[model samples]
Target: MLFVEAKWLYNDALTFMNDHDINDYDSKTLTVHVLDKDRQPVTHELRYLSSQMRQSVIQGIKNNMKSLATLRKHDRKTGSLKYKSEYLSINLQQSGVTYKFYDKRHIRIQGFKKGIRIEGTNQFWNIPSLEFANAKLLNLPDGYYIAITTYQTKRSEERKYKPSIGIDMGIKTTITVSDGRKVKVLVEESERLKKCQRLIARRKKGSNNRYKAGKLLRRAYQKLGSKKRDAANKIVHELLEHERLYMQDENISGWHKGLFGRTVQHSVLGLVKAKLMKNERVTVLPKSAPTTKYCPHCGKLKKDITLFDRVYECTCGYREDRDIHAARNMILLSGLSTCGTQEINAFGEDVRHWQNSAVQPR
Candidate 1:
């Protein structure tokens, strides 16, 4: 009922904002406009949406407006907000005022009469110095979820970190580290997911059975998403154990349209890239950088390398694994000319000669 009312309020605000300023819209009103089966407008009153939740709906529009304006300022194409048929999330802006946690397993949200039992609270239950902030109520196919934002003070103790390394993302071997750790990543869809998809496709459209089938399909996809996220999390955590990480900005999505679409789709390369890019310890070289083309040992560009070349062989008598070689260049070739650690040959030319400083691939 809360989410249904939220969708009504959001659509009403979007319609009103098309001609009027958002500031003039009232948030305390439970009355909203809806279209009936005859495509006629009718006044509907909300029963479960509190004033705070109502205000959040309007605030979402304001945030979208700012986002669109920012995109336009950067010369990106933009569009007006569209009306939502179903709202999936609602911001509970104030802790204790809008929502409260009764215990590790129970929580209370505004406009609800009873406290809801939640299962995932044990993940962060007894953390020291943890502070809860604003949370979002999420409506998913499986069930309702409350995503709470929490903060913890910085610990004085520093964690031990390994030596710096570079990474190379690929198709067959999902991730190849400079230290010779090649992680093959692929999570195939489960048999249940395929069955759910087939069931949904055969059901009659607009029927209750179709809706139930659709729900089952969505839940299956959710499970698949969870597996990908867990894999990405583990890989990111392991990579972050190093003191620093260097990687090139490769277009993983572009591969999805190419010959290896199925392979790319099943891999979690996109998720790994996103999570790793967020860390301060990670250094992302520009796409224009010749991470694969540059020869680290001979200090020369090997322009003849192709997709079929699994091993990088240079005429200067240096050879290495293709992905490992590229991974090594990530650490050695990136901006070496500008940094103070650059080495000079006898001819006074810039050369990359710090191979001993990097991790040797086994």
Candidate 2:
């Protein structure tokens, strides 16, 4: 009931915003007429959704509007927000006020009279000086989940630091680290997923069986997504343990359009790239820097390399595995290239012309 009402209110607010400015839309007096599953119009008050939930919906729309405006300001192609058919998340804007932890594994929401049982609280239960902030209630395919944001003081600890490393992302083997490590992170589709898809396709449209099949399909997708996230987190955590990281800004989207698109997608290359980019210690080289084509030994670009070549052979008698060569080049390029000269220009070359000329022998 809460999620349904939130969706209704969101669509209503979006319609109002289209006709008028967001500030002019009245949240208190606005009433939405909802329809039953049989297409009968029924009127009701905002009983299920709390005041904060309604406010969160409005704030969400406003934030999306601001984001679109920012994109337009930067000359990006923009589009209007479409009405949502389903709403699966609600934001509890305050911790102590809107929600409170009753115990280690139970919580009370604003509208509910009794506490709700929750799992996965054992990790943060016994921690000292823990502070709770805002939380989100998620309606997922498997079950309901509450994600709480908490803050705690950092504990200083003695740490062992490893040498700086570089990584090259590839479709064949997810990542190739500079220290001669090739990690494969491919989560192939399970048999259950394929069976669920087949069942969903066989069911008649608009029937209850079809609805059940659709639920199963969603659950399968959710499981697959969880596997990808777990793999990415583990890989990133291991990589960040080093003092520094060097990686290239790869063209993952272009890989999606190529012949090996499905291979790249299944391997989760994009997710790994995105996670690595967020780290403060990671330095990203330009996409046109030719990490794979440039010979690290002689500093000459080999334009004849193809995807079929697993080994990189240079005219200066330098030979190595293609992916390893690219990973090693990340370190060399990071030292030779300046921070300000990292972005490429329209000619598919670095913006700094002198840096290119300086690298070539006379």
Instruction: Please identify model 1 stretches exceeding 4 Å from their true place.
Output: 13-26, 37-44, 62-78, 204-208, 285-305, 312-320, 334-362
Q: Cα RMSD (Å) per model?
A: 5.5, 6.7
Measured with C-alpha atoms, the lDDT of residue 298 in candidate 1 is: 55
* Candidate with the greatest lDDT versus the true structure: 1
Worst 10 residues of 2 by lDDT: 338-347
Q: What is the lDDT of residue 224 in candidate 1?
A: 94
Best by TM-score: 1
Candidate 1's TM-score reads 0.79
Clashing pairs in 2: none
- List TM-score per model, in order: 0.79, 0.77
Q: Which pairs of residues collide in candidate 1?
A: none
